[model samples]
Target: MSSVESVEEFRAEFRGWLRAHLTGGFADLRGRGGPGREHEAFAGRLAWERHMAEHGWTCVGWPVEYGGRGASTAQQIAFHEEYALADAPARVNHIGEQLLGPTLIAHGTDEQKRRFLPPVRAVEELWCQGYSEPDAGSDLAGVRTRAALRDGRWTVDGQKTWTSLAHEAQWCFVLARTTPGSRRHAGLSYLLVPMDQPGVQVRPITQLTGTSEFNEVFFDGARTDAAHVVGAPGDGWAVAMATLGYERGVSTLGQQVGFRRELEALAALARANGALADPLIADRLTRAWTGLQAMRAAALRPGTAPSTAKLYWARWHRDLGELAMDVCGAASLTAAGVHGDPYEPDDWQRLFLFSRADTLYAGSDEIQRNIVAERILGLPKEVRA
Candidate 1:
């Protein structure tokens, strides 16, 4: 196939492969084999990761020397768009692949790359971020998690909040302070930590929705070999910022795509409940659609998009959720996916609940706007020491 034809062929062949290989519960995401089931969910997740890894999908954006397909940015984007349309679950090892893996490619030692990349590419060891602290949500630089190098090892101590997938993850790419007496942003270092060890404590945080996708992680003298540092000492802030940028920026739009889908489902629900006729809901729907479009356009930008797309998603998701709830009305009976929908049993009820986090996690909407205003807009900084 020609280059152009190859991409098109990849898409067509991929769609068929998805349909064929996606049976036994993946066919209908709402049925038996969805993210709702732990084993099945992880299985489906690993299945896709392995298939992609086999097809060189997992490491598409990585360089050829690092066992990646070395696919172009545009091709990668197209692959993601198509994957989004196919309703793939979030990669079980996104922290490994999306966050740490890339940083490793850019900054890791040769030993680190060879040791970490292949396992990450195969989804063997899941990873999570050890950022957010009880006091350092938006103000990441304020994180108090300190790591002191002792003899030939590092002793880590502190807490991390809202760490997603801590329960299932094997390791965490952590940002901890290694040098003392330096400013908040100075002297910090990034380290890869094993979650199953004795020094780490995982406490699940149940949301208002009664599900705990994120957890509070505490470390008391967590020991690590000094060899695990991602880069030079004191580079943690920059590395963390880059990771946050990737999360909010266009690099990892899988979650944003998830939000877009949730928004789409909301629209369909409005039509079914006759809420499409409600002037308020209709107006809200128009706004939501516009917001989603803007998100898509923003996410498609070539580079980091300079401007982050998180705030847009945060606003759009919360608004869309409220709109869906309103259209369902007061008489709506304990609405849920199982409650009722004009089409399939699945809809945005649970997704609406999930959207509440869109603003809070991955830096709040307030934080995203602060970033855009201060950094992108060159506005005055917020006043507070």
Candidate 2:
């Protein structure tokens, strides 16, 4: 689309495209893959995403030269909102497209952009984040994963836990210590390492929802080219933070759409089950609706801290899940099985279970609060022991 195109035009174009193309083959995929439901229709979702890439729909916010529309912020928001309204399947390559792709674009060499951005834009390659470790999740600077430069390559050796989609990714952007004896945020290098090699192993960590959307990745002497490092060597903290910043960017509007849908459905369920008659449940539902509106307002407002957004949404969603359980009352306690599986959670059960990690993942509530305090509120930094 031309840069001059209005946001509504962009929204209409995207909505129309989804209407025309998300059919027959892709119809079943609508609302299939998302939080806790990622295991649903994997191959089909992948195919549908690739199809979006074919029509210049994927990576709409990226630069046009990098196979994107170079969409404005308003246009991007419109795109996401329209996508959610259409009930499209959750994207399969968000780690690549949102986090790594933007990081590479900003800090990567020209060669890196040429080699990496195309595949990410096309959804031909999948990527995972290798930032969090078993012992250093929220304390990202305490990463112990080490990469040694040897014979024109970086030999990485360590474990990265809670690696989302590591099993499906072709590569991972890892933050590993390159300088020996380096402590905390110092001497780290961001290396792009291949996931298909023998030195790399991904063991799925079954989540509370009884699915393994994330994994523990063991990098036993995993190797990547020396040139694969983004930014200067031993300066990975900034790059990693940049990736995290991108992680919370424009795609959130789409997420809000999903949240709204969940809220509406919960409201309906409450009415159906006579839970809405209770004043407490009704009051909670009203608050949820208003809170969602506030979230949307915060998102559009310029200079609203990203940590603030993350903190608000994570807690809200987790609360919504709890509210859902309350609405279900006794029904939420029991599991419903299909196809002889002894343990199958209904939607409400799954929401409650999966949302338990909402405040913990991405960045935990404590960490986000710290960020807001030190950065936005001008509070003193917490002293390290």
Of the candidates shown, which would achieve the greatest TM-score relative to the real structure? 2
For each candidate in turn, the TM-score is 0.88, 0.99
- Which segments of model 2 are wrong by more than 4 Å? none
lDDT of 2 by residue, 1-30 (tens): 546799888888888999999999899998
The alpha-carbon root-mean-square deviation between model 2 and the true structure, to one decimal in Å, is 0.8
| Deviation (Å) of 359 in candidate 2 | 0.3
Off by over 4 Å in 1: 1-7, 25-40, 249-257, 303-307, 331-347
- Weakest 10 consecutive residues of candidate 1 by summed lDDT: 30-39
lDDT of 1 by residue, 1-385 (tens): 2134466666676667666765665554422222222334566666667766776567666777887666665666666666667776655666787778788887889999988888888878888899989988888888889998899888899999989889889888888888887767898899888888899999988764545777999999888888888889789888887776555533445555666676677678778878889898888878877877777777776554444666666767777767767877773436444425432223345445666776777777677788888988899999977
Measured by lDDT, the strongest candidate is: 2
Q: Which residue pairs clash in candidate 1?
A: none
Position 57, candidate 2: lDDT: 89
Candidate 2 positional error at 167, Å: 0.6
